[model samples]
Target: MGTTTLIAVAATGLMAGVFFAFSVAVMPGLADLTPEHARGAMRRINARIQNPVFLLVFLGTAVVCGIEVFQGRIAGGLLYVLGCFVLTMAVNVPMNNRLERTDDAYWPEYLRKWTLWNHVRAACCLASTVTLLLGL
Candidate 1:
């Protein structure tokens, strides 16, 4: 229960909540809209989510997890970094960038794939939180 690990737990939990909300509420709400409307809304959401507060939680949590990994909180920290952070960097972000560049025709596939991967991220964040708490 060091301060760093506590921070890791809080951050990861927050991330999990965000992803979970998207999975359960946001995406579903978007899906209800027409493709053009959904695409536009998602694009705006993607842009808006890059703000400072979100970045501080997202990137800052990854940085903290990296530190935790080296400090021997390997299981939880590594899971957060690799599963959530790296996965977002590798998969979700690319899809989002593609969504921004492409037209509404891409919305169906994008919604499906993005939501699927987001579920993964949410699970990872939750698991990371639990493991980190257990490690404490």
Candidate 2:
């Protein structure tokens, strides 16, 4: 791989790692809080972490992944990344907009949907990562 391809892959890997750690591990633990005070604190953390800036960064990283795929016949990776990008723009963004407008009380339901979409995105990201790694 060229320098650009290596850089892109590294960036994608880093983004995916951070996202998996936070979304799958940290956020779930935070969401499991029991007491009202603790729940409130967790909610605040989630809100702060899932802000627009974070989404933009995530989207941008996916774009870089798409670009990296162009270095070779990484059609599968490109397709997966494109699918993820479309889903984020079409579904995730709107849901997040609703989340931002709503109260914390409605977060459980939103979080459920968010988690589902996030899992889909993570799968696609992983597929792309593996494809790139295998030089497929």
The candidate maximizing TM-score is: 1
Please write out the lDDT profile of model 2 over residues 1-136, one tens digit for every residue. Answer: 7665565556556556665775788658756764354346655665786767776667666666666667673753474566467777787678767665666676677667766776776666666666666676
TM-score, per-candidate, Cα-based? 0.98, 0.70
Question: How well does candidate 1 match the true structure in TM-score terms?
Answer: 0.98
> Best lDDT goes to which candidate?
1
- By summed lDDT, the worst window of 10 consecutive residues in model 2 runs over 34-43
Error of 1 at 75 (Å): 1.0
> RMSD in Å for candidate 1, one decimal?
0.9
Each prediction's whole-model lDDT (CA): 0.96, 0.64
